[model samples]
Structures are given as C-alpha cells and as structure tokens.
Target: MSQSVAARPRSLWRDRNFLTMWSGQALSQFGEQITGLAIPVLAVLLLHATEFEVGLLNAAGVAAFLVVGLPAGAWIDRMRKRHVMIWADAVRAVALATVPVLWWLGWLDIWHLIAVALVFGIATVFFDVSYQSIVPSLVPAAQIPEANGKLESTQQLAGIAGPAIGGWLIGILTAPLAVLATVGTYIASFIALCLTRDTEVVAPRDEHEPLLRSIGEGLRWVFGNRYLRRIVGTTGVSNLFSTISFTMLPIFILRDLGLSPEAMGVIFSLGAIGGLLGAMATPHIVRWIGEGRAIPVSAIGFSVIGLFLPVAALAPAVAFPLLVAQSFVASFTVLLYNIVQVSFRQRITPKRLLGRMNASVRFCVWGVMPLAALAAGGLGAWLGVVPTMWIGAIGGLVSAAFVVFGPFWAMRELPAALEEADADASR
Candidate 1:
C-alpha cells in the first residue's frame, strides 16, 4: 500500500479546477507583460511624454491599488471569488480594447492612456486579491508552494516572451495596435475563468452589519494579528523603496545612459530569465533556508540589489550588464519572498477573512508605489537623473535595514499554527 501511494505521480494535472485557473492566469500574465511594454513605448514614442508624465502613468496604476484595495477586498468577501475574477477580466478587456479604438480615431492622448491604466489596474487589484484568497480553499496546504511556484514560473516565461512579442508587434503594427493583442488575451482569460468549475464560495452572513463595519473588522483582523502586522510592515517598506528605484531606472537608462527602446526591451527580456530561474529554484530555496527564514532574508536581498542600478552609470559598456544582473537578482529574491509570504498568509488566514486581508495587504504595500514614482520623477527633474538614482538606491538600502533588524529576521521555521495545518493537509 505504501509503495502504491508513493508511485502515484505528484502533479496538479489531476486537479481540473487548478488547471483551469492556472491556464487563465498564464494567459492573463502574458497579456499584462505586453501592456507593460506597450504603455511606456506608447508614451515615449507617440505622445512624446516627459519623464514626469511617464511617472504619472505608473502612479496612476498604483493609485488604483491604493484607492480600491480595501473596498474591493470587502466587496470580494461579499461575492464568489470566481465571479469577481470573471468580471475583473471582462473589465480589463474592455479597458484595453479602448486604446486601439481611440488611436484609430486620432483621439489617443496621455490622459486616455492614464485612464485606461488606472481602471485596468483597479480591476487587476480585485482579481488578484480574490485569486490569492481563493487558492488555499482550492488546494491543500502542502500544494500551496507548488502552485505559487508554477504561477511564478509562468510569469517569468511570459516576461521573456511577452515583451519580445510586444516589441516586434510594435515594430510592425505600432504601439496602439500592439495593445489589441492584450485585449484578446484578456478575452481568452475571461472565457477560461468562466469555464472554471469549483465549489462555490459562500458569502459571509452579515446582512445586518454595515459595509464600513465589516471593512473595519477586516482591517483590524489583519493589522491586529502579530504575524500579519510584521509581514505587512516588512513588505510595505520594501515595496516603497523598490518603487522609487524602479521609477528612476527608466529615466536613468533613457536620459543618462542613452539606450534605445529596442535595447531596453532586450534588457528587460534578458532580466526576465532571472525570474524564470528564481521560480524554478524557489521550492528548493524554501527547503534549504526553511520557509520562515527565507522571507526576511529574500526581502533584504531584493533591497540590497536595488542599490546596484545607480552604480551602473560608472561604465557605459558594463552598465547595461550590471543592470541586467540587478534584474536577475531582484527577480530571484522577490520570488523567494513571495512564495513564502503568500503561502504563509494562505495557511493562516481564515477563508471568511481572506479577501479583506489580501486587499488590505495590497493597500498598504503597493499603495505607496505611485507616490514613490512621482517623487522619483520630481526629484530627478530637480537633481538630475543620476543624483535621483543615487538617492533611490540609498533609500533601498535603508528599507532593508527595517526588516533585517526586526523580529522577523529570527523566524527560522513555519509558525506553530501553520505547521499543524500542513500536517492536517498531508493526511
């Protein structure tokens, strides 16, 4: 009997529900990568946007994360997560489709682009918060890391291929038409989501309770927990600094380094290979470091690597390669952090509180991304791009100090509650 059990193939292949969600996620991520290329290319090429304007666009996206995160979490808790995902996909499809239409009408402008980015970003927050909350309900706790690893791996593959495709498509059809491809990808994802079959999530029974009260409870529950508070604080500080660094990177590349669009695309694609390697290696990393120790260390590692970007300008020939190295290290470190953090959160969070908790986390962490972008752009405008990048790097170093010095650094094993849950699932 033991031999027979051991002989069974370890794969998510037999799980039809996970398969459906994974396939849809793969397609959605591909579309997202294309847009990540399309948006900046469109701004720089078509609208002749200034550095500040480009930063504004990025800020617009994160602004959505800030504004809608908590409410969306509450809203998600009130409906089936799958339904929320389908609706979010449908909304994104419509938002992306508008780009091609407006471009054809000679009505394309930065405002239109920013609007699309913001709305699509909001929908994405809803989809992501719900998706993260629902995954634990769909799979046993032991499979959580495997599922997240596969998802991260798919994201890396998309990062590699999607930008290459987007770059080529832009070269052939121009930026506006390149966006249409993303629209189609979203439609495919929407259909796939609609096809997903799983046990429906029941909305929590709280009809007499006010929405604000429920939202407040979620906020309290997430922030009230000792473990959750530490995770949020660590992630929020890390993200803020990283955002500042990222916001300045494009400016430093274009204005200071004088790299071309095609060159930047290649650099991004090459950097994506780092994420692929990171994803492939996460399971092993978790085992080696132990999941608890992995999170804070990886978070610190990611922050440390951010300092390398500003140092790239010293040698033009080696600058791009150094930047690529930064990308690789950043991808690896961030993925390691994510796999552990997401799995830990999934294990600890109750099903009823999942949506609100996930959203609240995003609200706090990514909420500052846009502000950081704006500050980087403004500071770069005042101090010059190189100086701004130096400041950003310094900020990154400071960010790491918080998590490394905190109590989180000593977490060398799974929490007691989570270990018990994992044991239960393995049975």
Candidate 2:
C-alpha cells in the first residue's frame, strides 16, 4: 500500500488489488474522454452527417444500456469481472483504432462510424457492469465512499484534459487521425488492466437458473431497498432532464454561437476543471454533510442551476462563462451524487448479485437518455436552439423535484449509526 493510502485507515486505496483496479480505471478514463470529442468530430467533419444523424449516433451508444445491459450484467455476473473489463478495453481500443486505419485506406464513412460506435457502446456496457460489480470485493465497506470519490476525481481529470488534447490533435491532424490518441489511451488502459491482480471471488449461481427470474430478483433487490429506490428515481429523472440540455449544448456552441472547434474543446476542458475540484472535494463534503443529505442536495442544485445556461444568449461574450459555469455545477453535483450512490450500492449489495443490480439500476436511469437526446435534436431542428434550451431548462427543474419530494430529502445524515444498522440487518 502507498503511504497516502495508508494514512487513511480502512480505505480502498490501501488495498493492493483495488489500487491496481483504480489505476487501470483511471488510465482508461483518459481514452474515454477523447472519444467523446473525436467520434463526434468524425461523424460531423469526415462523414458529413446531419444534425439528426449526430443525435442518432449518440442514441446508438445509449442503446446498449437498454438492449444489452440486463443480459450483459447477468452474463458478467458469471465471469471474472477483471478479465471482462480487460477484454472490453481491448475491444474498444481496436474499434476506435479502426477509424484512423479506415481513414488511411480511404474507406471511412458514416455507416462505418456508426457501426464502430455501437460496438464500442456494447463493450462499455460490459465493462461498466463488471467494474461496478467488482468494487465491493476490492475494499472494505468503510472505504467505498473514498474509493468512489477517487475514481470520480480521476474521471473528472480525464474530462478536463482529453477534449482539449483531442481538439488540438484535430486541428493539427484532422478528426479521424486524432482518434489515434484515444486509441493510445485505451492501450494504456489495457496495459494497466493486465498489471492488476485480483483476489479470487465467487460468481453468481443464478445464471444457470431461469434468466428472467434471476434478472427479476436483482431488480427486486435494487428497487425494494428504500435507499437504492430513491437513488434510482432521483438520478433517473435528473439524468433524463439533463440529457435534454446536454445533448444540444455542442450544437448550440458550434452551430448557433459559431464557436470554433478549438474553442468548444477549450470550453469543455476548462469546465471540467470544476468537475475535478468537485470530485476531489466530494469525500470531504460527504463526511461533513453526511451522504444522504449531501447527495440529494447536489443533485437538486445541479439540475436547478443548469437552467442558467440559456441565459448565455444575453451576451455571446458571457456564453462560454455560462456554459462553463453550468458544466462546473452539473459535473460537481453529478459526481457527488454518483459517489454516494455507487458507494452505497457496493456496500449494500452482495457479491453474487452485484453485477445484475448495477446493470438493472443503470438501465432504468440511463436507457432514456438517448431518446431524450433525439428529442432534443428534433426539437432544436423544429424550434430554435434557444427555445429548445428553454424547454430543457424547465424540464430539468421539474425533475429535481423527484429528489425534493422523496424521502431522500428527509435523511439529513449517514453515519456510523447507519453502518451498524446495515450490519445488523445483514446478520
């Protein structure tokens, strides 16, 4: 264990196996960040896709969470999660690398880009399910929040740097070739995954049983639990509303505001700095405010404050600042919310059901996000960009009410007392 990890007793970072896992995850996140920009640029610049087509590309990615998430989760529950993650990363690297290769061969096209997107999306579903499921075995319950916080921080840092780098590469090398940088990140991720060692853990036995029954059991556990239920509901609604605005932000900036691609990259990267700060601070905030209250408070604030993005139309000079501010608040709030939710789920779920449980909830929460994106795009085409944004902002505020009206708002703290209660219940 490293000295920093050792300083924090009972922390996951102190565990050698989890340290390896976190390092691998962090490395992979860098590549994941580049893809968010590179892939879209490929579609828009190289393939000459339309606005609806761009929306379709995003929708296709989210399709995996809907179509394959449940079954993939169940399948992963029967396998070695670490290996699953490694293979997933490897597949993604190869798929992303194909873009550059095909471009060189003069074979790059919109359909090919879409195919790669779908494949990458499927791989992500598998990796995410495995990663979430395996966290419990990597650390003690007390360390889950800290582990989640650290992971969130790493992801935020990737968000901060990846787009800027991608934009720079695109400016110099073109969009297709810039994807090679993303591929390099995936390669690094794969290498890190190879170095990681995991302590042996048991797989779920329910895979051999009726598939529907097994899936149902996992769903029941997540939804039946009061805490998880509230989390799923709150996040799902918030995600739906947030997706509306997020889906159109790029279009608004690049098309409506006439910002250069480089400027868009800089804006995203700068805003991500706030995300990094938020993720770094999340553990402290949780400790101070308690997980229960802190988590929902951030969610509400993120959604409500998101409304201010449209105010940027008042002046183009302030547009970047407004966008950055929205990104800052939303990223911070979402990261904090994820920290609490992921840690709680890992702590409460049994190892046997972790994969399915993680997937089931994610499916419910994120499956609708793509459709929301499509709706945003269609609306943006029909109504103007500003009007579409207005709709999104209103929807986001209303979605925050899910948390406000729920029992999540009533729980002002999470402490050793709740831990003891969980211990007693588990026994």
Candidate 3:
C-alpha cells in the first residue's frame, strides 16, 4: 500500500528551498489580498465608478488568462520556471507602482486603472502558472498535499490579515497610497526568489514542434481525459458564478449596505478564517473519507452554504454575521476542494506536461471569469445589487450538479497516474 502523507517522517518546514518559496509566497499573497481590497475601494471611492465599471475593471484583471494562458504554458515549459516567476513578480511590482505615481500626478482615472489591471493580470498569469509548476520540484511527491496545504494556509492567512491592514491603510493613507504595500511585498518576494536555490530538471523538448501544436496537445490531454474533463466543467461553471457574486460583493457591502471600509475589511477577514481552517483540515479529511469522496462532499457544502451571501443583504441587523458566516463556509469548501484536486492533478500528470496541463485547466476554468464579471456588472446595474447576488448564488448552487451527477461521485480514491486511469477506462 502507498504511504500516507501523515506517515512521512520528513517535514517540509526544514527544507530550505521550500521555506524560502513559502515565505515569498506568503508575503506575496498578503500583498495581493491588500491590493485586491484596495483596487475596488479605489474605483468606488476615488473615481466613483459605476457597478459596470467596477466589473469591467475586475474583468480586465483576469482577462489575460483567456488571451495568453495557453502560450504562456508552452513558453514556461521551455524555460526555468523559477526565472519566469521572479520576472513575473518584478513586472507586477512595477505595474502596480504605476498606479500611485499616476494618482499622485493627478493623471489617474478609470482607464488607467483598467490598463494597469490588464498588465498586472498578464504578469499574474505567468507567475501563477510558474508557481504551480515549481512546487512539485521543490518537495517530494508524498509531501505535495502538505506543501499545498501549507501554502494555501498562508494564502488564507493573508486573506484574513491583508484586508484588515488594507482597510486600515485605506482609511488613513487613502486607497492610492495603500497600493504601495503591495509593491513592497512583491519586492520582498523577488528577493526571496533570488535567494532560493533549486536545480530544475528541464523536460526534453521537441524543437520542431510548433507552439500552437504544443498548446493543442495540452488541450487534448486535458479534454481527452475523463477525470480532468469533469473537473474542468465543474470548476468552469463554479468560477463563472463565483466571479459574479464576488464582483458585486463590494458594491453590496459598500454602496447598498453603507458599511465603512474598516467594517468591510473586518467582515472579509473574519470570513477568510474558514479557508485557513479548511486547509488545515484537508489532509485529515482526505485520510478519513478518502480523496475522491472529499470532492463531491466539499462541492455540495460549497453550493449550499454560498446561498447565505445573497441572503445577508436582506437583514440589516444580521448582515455582518451573515456575511462572515457565508465567507467562512464558502472559503472552507473551496479550499478543501482545491487542495485535493490540485494534488490529484499534479500526481496524475507527467512532469513534461505539468505546465501545459495546468495552463490548460486554468484556461478552461478562469477563461469564463471576464465574461461573468461583465455580465454581473450589467446585471447589477439593471436589476440592482441584491437581485444580482441572487442570480449569482442560485447559479453557484446549480453548479454542484455538474459534480454530483458526474463520474466523480463514483470515485473513492484517485487513480495513481494517467496510465492507470486509461486502463480502467478500457475495462
């Protein structure tokens, strides 16, 4: 029998390279959270952007995945993933710094914000793709779940703290200057990347293969596989509704509910604790119930509990608690689903195809976000914020059907590799 993650004697915390990567990622995630909160607040307060405009800005931030995601995977596969990540961080730092400079010079506007968000998004696509590819190289395969859990926990912690600090900074320093915090974190992450030493074993390349063909190979690999296809379908539909709800959340809390920035930050921070808890509990849950079974259960919980978000707007007295409850439940379920699935994806894929495989999945999953954001914006403007929330919530709940009724429900544990999966299919 295969050794479980808990039975492994070696700890990830002692690995120097992993620690360096972890520190940088933690700082970076915190910075990202800060900027995540600050950007919408800036658009809402400084430029007085309409709901559609805010949605457009959100759309611009993730639109690069649809544009360059596939080619980026192909390119990263040919180069050192660490170098790609470091450069991506530097580019993002510089792109984000432009906002404060523009704001200080009185040249900042909604258009400038959109342009910066687009640039930052492009850089983020490369960074995230590289980040995912590099982690497997830095640690043993048995420890991947633990490594991912730790990294995800840090991200969740950042989600908890970054917003509170960002809200405080926004209240005092104003939204534009609050962005500088992100710049600092990116710089810190860059230095951490520079310090880390890992010997990358590059996959043998076919120099004659065209980039488009390589991308197509990845698409085929993902879509041709039954397991990956189901994951993609569920995640794609879930992300579409998630973007809709999250895009409108700030508008609901700030404009409709008339909550202060600090209060908003606190609500988000408290809600984020669920993610941290989920990350911590994932391994135990997997060990207890088995990995494949965890996915559908988490999906169900994610769908049912997310309905509370839209309901929060209905009651003024309970809005704060309701939002917090919704956030915790939503974050927990999503993290639980993500850690297990990502680990399974990494294990089943060949190292040569890792970057492309990840990129392909991200393309399918995240590609819908921009369109969804725009749709949410349009819906929010026409139907009002509360009604838009209902649409998103109901849509999110329906997304669970994709998993519950699919092949995943029959899976108890994931297949060890693609070959095993294929063999099973043939039977």
Q: Which candidate, 2 or 3, has the higher TM-score?
A: 3
What shift in Å separates residue 409 of candidate 3 from its native position after superposition?
3.1
Model 1 root mean square deviation, Cα atoms? 3.5
Residue 410 Cα positional deviation in candidate 2, in Å, after optimal superposition: 3.1
Q: Give me the overall lDDT of model 2.
A: 0.77
Query: What lDDT, from 0 to 1, does candidate 3 have?
Result: 0.88
Error at 315, model 1, angstroms: 2.0
**lDDT tens readout by residue for model 3, 10-90:** 778788888998999899999998898899899987899999998999999999999999998888888888999999999
Q: Order the numbered candidates by TM-score, best leading.
A: 3, 1, 2
Compared with the true structure, the alpha-carbon lDDT of candidate 1 equals: 0.80
lDDT of 2 by residue, 122-164 (tens): 9999988888877666666666667777778889998898889
| Residue-by-residue lDDT tens digits, candidate 1, 1-427 | 6998986646787888788888888998998888888888788768977778877888988888788888888888888898899999999999989999999999999999989989988988988998888777667767877888888889999988887788788788898998888888888888888888756567647562577876887788677666667778778877776777777666667556887656676777888998898888878887787767777788778888987888897777899899888888888888888878887777776777788888889999889888888887787667877777777777777665545666565666766485554343344
Best by lDDT: 3
Candidate 3 stretches greater than 4 Å from native: 1-9, 203-208, 422-427
Estimate every model's Cα lDDT from 0 to 1: 0.80, 0.77, 0.88
